[model samples]
Target: MRRLALPLAACLLLAGCAPTVSLTPAPQATAVGCASLIVGIRGIETIGDAQRRQTDAQGTAAWGTPASVTLYCGVETPEASALPCTTQSGVDWLLSESGDERIATTYGRAPGVQLITTRDASVNDALETLSGAVATSTRGTDRRCLADPGASATPSAIP
Candidate 1:
């Protein structure tokens, strides 16, 4: 019994000296909205390789960033709106960004000519910070058009 008590005491002392470890949880993800534009200019073939340079220059001057020139998703037809994505020079462009990862494209169309409409951090973020505000279906409503936010223009009018 005496020997057992000494060993137990030593074990207890050793156990008390052992360090306790802990871990901290990482932060949650964030979201955002950023502008993106897709335009298909006519006479593109005639422009030839110059189209590449011209598109790049135009995008840099307009978006002040590396614009990815690609195909047009617009279905051009007289049946379309007056300033449809096909006819208009630009559209309301926005994409979402969460920390290092790009969340997704917020607004369907481009963000229009003016990249930064407001000095708001989201606008300046270049990469947007989004939330449940996006990722939802949006009907053709001028109310939510960042290109011309709340303009007194009609659906057929390009504000």
Candidate 2:
């Protein structure tokens, strides 16, 4: 009974340390690339382990209470059609918004990335913190948001 008790306690301890993020794993085909993305993310700005959630997905991360920021490492590439693309911190992200949250992803890149952030959060800061990781972990392309010929402010791109 003593030996059984010790083993049971160990099992409980391990379970307690398990990841709490509840992400659905990406498809097996994309898992490998997703795994690569996770390997590069040693840390994210202002986010700690306690804030991270356990995800079932192969390559995904979440932060903040109730997860104000959620990121998926590998997703299907976006279509070539004209979508609102924005470039920041040397990264090109196709933007989409619903309610108070915004979703952005690397435009025209394989092993795609998706970042979700609440409106209250600083999108620029999030982009700055994540762009380097996304650029390092995935493939990139020449495609970008077309510059407005008449607009005075030209968009910036990371070389």
Candidate 3:
């Protein structure tokens, strides 16, 4: 009994130290192109000082011990909206804020990617680092940020 109790306690201790992150998978995560996109994102080793944590959901990823950042791929592509859009590493992202969280969604890409992070996190740095994979994996569309000069509209007409 003593030998069994010692090993059981050690196992419990090891389990407590294991890193895990809980995240909700995107609704369209099983869409045709999403698997490839997830593969690209999973290739990312780290974000800032946040290392990857094991997540239970498919097409979802979380970084940091307490999950400072999370990504969900294969959400519905967003239509034109008033949301501020910015281009990072050749990918257009629509940005929004909800209290303490900052959200960025890939614009003009089929089977969109959404990123959620704490407001204090280095979102720009994470976007920059993740952009390469997103650009390579996702399918692009004709949609462009209205502020982009190259977008097919007269310069004077842009707000």
The top-ranked prediction according to lDDT is 3
Task: Write the number of the candidate with greater TM-score, choosing between 1 and 2.
Answer: 2
| Residue pairs with backbone overlap in model 3 | none
User: What is the full ranking by TM-score, best candidate first?
Assistant: 3, 2, 1
| Clashing residue pairs for model 2 | 20-54, 21-53, 21-54, 25-57
**Candidates 1 and 3: which is better by TM-score?**
3
List ranges where model 1 is wrong by over 4 Å: 1-40, 46-68, 72-90, 95-140, 143-159
| Global Cα RMSD, each model | 22.0, 6.1, 6.3
User: Scored by CA lDDT, what does every candidate get?
Assistant: 0.26, 0.66, 0.77
Tens digits of per-residue lDDT for model 2, 49-149: 22555556667887765677788876776567454667665667876667888777777666788887775455555677778877777777766656453
User: What lDDT would candidate 1 get against the real structure?
Assistant: 0.26
Model 3 lDDT on a 0 to 1 scale: 0.77
Q: Judge candidate 1 at residue 146 and give its lDDT.
A: 34
Instruction: Single out the weakest 10-residue window by summed lDDT for candidate 3.
Output: 150-159
Best by TM-score: 3
**lDDT winner between candidates 2 and 3:** 3
lDDT rank, highest first? 3, 2, 1
lDDT of 2 at 17: 69
